[model samples]
Target: MIRRPDSLKTFLQAGALAGLCALALLQAPKQAIAGPSGVAGTALFQQFPLLYQGVLVEGMGGAFTAVADDSNAPFYNPAGLDNIQSSSFQILNISADISYPSLYPTLYNGVSGAGNNNQNYINAFSSVAGQSLYARVGDYSNYTTHDFAIGLLSNNQMLGVANASPTTTNLGSLAALSDSGVVISGAYGFFNHHLQVGGTLMGLYQMFENIPSLSKTQASALSSTLSDNLSYGFGLVGNLGAIYHFDLPLNPTLGASILNVGTANFGNAGSLPQLINAGVGIDPDIGFGRLLADIDYVDVTNYLYYTGDSLWLHTRFGVQYQFPEILTVSAGLYEGYPTFGVGIDLWAVEVNASYYTEEASPVPGLNPDHIVSLQVAFGWM
Candidate 1:
C-alpha cells in the first residue's frame, strides 16, 4: 500500500498554489462567446470542451464524477485519488475514434463527383446536410500513488457538416482542433478519510480551425496548406473537486467539481467555458462481481447558448459490472442516447471499446452523432 507523505500541510499548500495560479492566468470575457464564424442556419450548442475523455468514461455515459477511482480521477474528481491503495503507472494509452462511419462511403462518392460545379457541390452537400462526420486520435499516460498524480495527454479531432440552410452561400463547414497538455494533481482526506478534497493544474497548448462557410470556390482549390488558417494559443486552467463517502449500504458517495475555474482564453482559438457538475454513486460487492451505479448532472451552469435543449441533455446515468481481473461491461445514457462499453484486462495489457451517441443540435435526437472508440494500454497496477 502507498504511504501518506510525512506532512499533509505541505501537500495542501502545493495544491492550493496550483489552483490559484491557474485561475489567475486568465480573465474571463464579459461578453458571451460568439458562434462558429460564418456558418449559416442552426448550429449545435457547444458545452464542456474537455481536454481529454477516456473510452471507459464515455462508455459509461460520461457519469464518472462520483466513481472516479482510476487514472481518470484527475480529470473528473481528483479527490477520488485518495481511494488508491497501491501505486499505478500507465506506460502508454493510445486511442482512435470515428463517428458515423456507415455514411463515409456515400459522402466520399458524392464529394468525388461534385468537381468544380456549384450546383453539384450543393447537391452533394444537401444529401448529407445536418449529418456529422468526425475522426480523432489521442493518447494519455499517467502515474498515481495515493494522494498525488501527474499525467500527459494529447488529442486531434476533425469534424465536418454541410450547411443546414440551402439558401446560404456555403456548401459545408469544417473544423479541426488539437490540444496537448500536462496535468498535475493533489488531494487530501479529512474526517478519517470519509471526505476528500483535491485540485488540479492543467497547462495546455491548443490549436483550432473553423471554416463555417466552405464555399464552392474554396472546396475546388483545397490544398495541404489549408491548416494556415488555424489559430493557436497556450493557457492554463484549474479544477477543484470533493467527494464525501457516506456510511450507508452499497458504499454510497457524493461528488462535485468546479471545472475550468475562471475559464481559459486560448487567444483566437476560443475559450474553455466554466462548468459545475455533481453526481451520486454506489459501489457494492455482490458475491460474484461488483456492481456500480452513478447518476450525474453536468454543465449545471448552462453555458449552452442555444435554445431547445432539455434537462435530459445534461443528465447522465450509468451502470457497470466487474469480474475481478477478467472482464468488465458497462451501459448508460448520454444526452438521452444509449451507450455501451466493454473492457478486458490481462495483467500487463488492457483493451477497451465503447459505442455512444452525441447530440449535435439544440434538441436531443434531432442530430445524432454515433461514435465508436477503442483504446489499448500497457500498465502496471
Candidate 2:
C-alpha cells in the first residue's frame, strides 16, 4: 500500500497542471502521413488485444501451448484436445480483472478535498488509467475420434474522469471500448496419436466511444448525449496449431501455433496482429504429485516484420504441481513478470484464482498493472 502524505492536495494541483499540458498536446493538429510512419503501431495492438485465456494457463504464466489438454486448448494449442478421453463439457466459465486501484491515489485517495479548479483535470487523467473487464462462456466436448468446441467471449475497457464536486454528476471525459466474439475449434490426431493438429475460426464484433475533454459550455448537454457517439464493426480471424508428443521419458511435448493468421479486422476500427507461437512442456509423475514445466516463445514474426525489439520475443515460463485430483498450484514468469495461481477441485466443480501483472508498455519505464481473477468451472467426465 502507498502511504499518503498530508500534502496530497498539493500533489493534485501539480497533477492538474500536467493534465492541462497533455490536453493541449492532444488538441494539436496532425500531419497527413503514409506507410509505416502512418501506422499506429504498438498503441493500436495494445487496445483490447486477445489475451492469454483460462485461469489455469494464466496461473501458469501463459506457458500452456504444449501443456494444453483441457477446454482452453482451443485458445492455446487446440491439438491437445485429442488427448481428452471423456466427453467433457464446460458448463460456464467467467473471468474478470481490474488493476489495483490503490496505486492511483490521486483518483481515489484524498480526492474529495481537491479544489474545484483541479478536479476536472484530475478526472481527465483518471480516464486513461488502464481499467478493463472480460468475461467468456464456452463448452468443449470430445467425439469418437475428433474433438471440437465452441465459445463466446467478450471484453470491455473504460477510462474516464469523474467530477469530485458533491453537486455534479458529470464525468469530465470518457472512453469505452469493447469486443465480443464467437470461436469454433476442432482437433484431430494422427500417427498413432503422436501428432495432433487443430484449428479455430472466430467471428468478432468491436465497439469504441470517446468523449472529448469537456468544455464548461458543453459539459451539461454533452454529458447527457454521450451514448450517441459509439461506433462499432465486425470481422473474422483464424488460428492453426499442432502438437507432437515424444515417446521418451516424462512424455515431453512440443507445440506450435499461428494465431490471427489473416490479420482479422473490425471494419475501420483496427486489426489484430498475426502471431506465431511455439512451446515445450515436460510433465513427470512424482510419488504424491505431478510436476509440470513449460516454456513458450511468442510473436515470432514480430522480430522480422517489425523492429528487432526484445518485447517481440515475449517469452513465458511456468511450473505447476498437481496433488492427485484435489488441488493444483502454479507459478510463472509471464513475459518477465511474476504470476501465481491455484486450483481446487470439489466434487464436480473446480475453482481457480490467479494474480498476474502486465506491463502497460513493452517499451519500459511505465508502471505495471496488476489483476486478480477468479473462475468457477463445472463439468463431468
Best by lDDT: 1
lDDT of 2: 0.60
Q: Each prediction's TM-score against the native?
A: 0.86, 0.71
Local distance difference test values of all predictions, in order: 0.74, 0.60
Q: Summarize candidate 1's per-residue lDDT along 1-381 as a digit string, tens digits.
A: 112333464466446444533443332233235333311122322522556777888889989888777777888888888877778777898887788665567767877887767777777778777788777888888888899999898888777776776423687777777889998999888756666788889898988777777877777666633656778899887888887666567888787777777766677777776666789999775888778888998866555543224888888889988887679999999989999999988868889999988787778778888999999989975
Clash pairs of candidate 1? Answer: none
Candidate 2 lDDT tens digits, 3-100: 22235543553353344334323322221121211012432234224433577788888788777777777777777778766565555555555556
Which portions of model 2 miss their true places by more than 4 Å? 1-44, 101-146, 157-177, 209-229, 303-308, 311-313, 364-366, 379-381
What is the lDDT, from 0 to 100, of the residue 254 in candidate 1?
A: 80
Judge candidate 1 at residue 96 and give its lDDT: 75
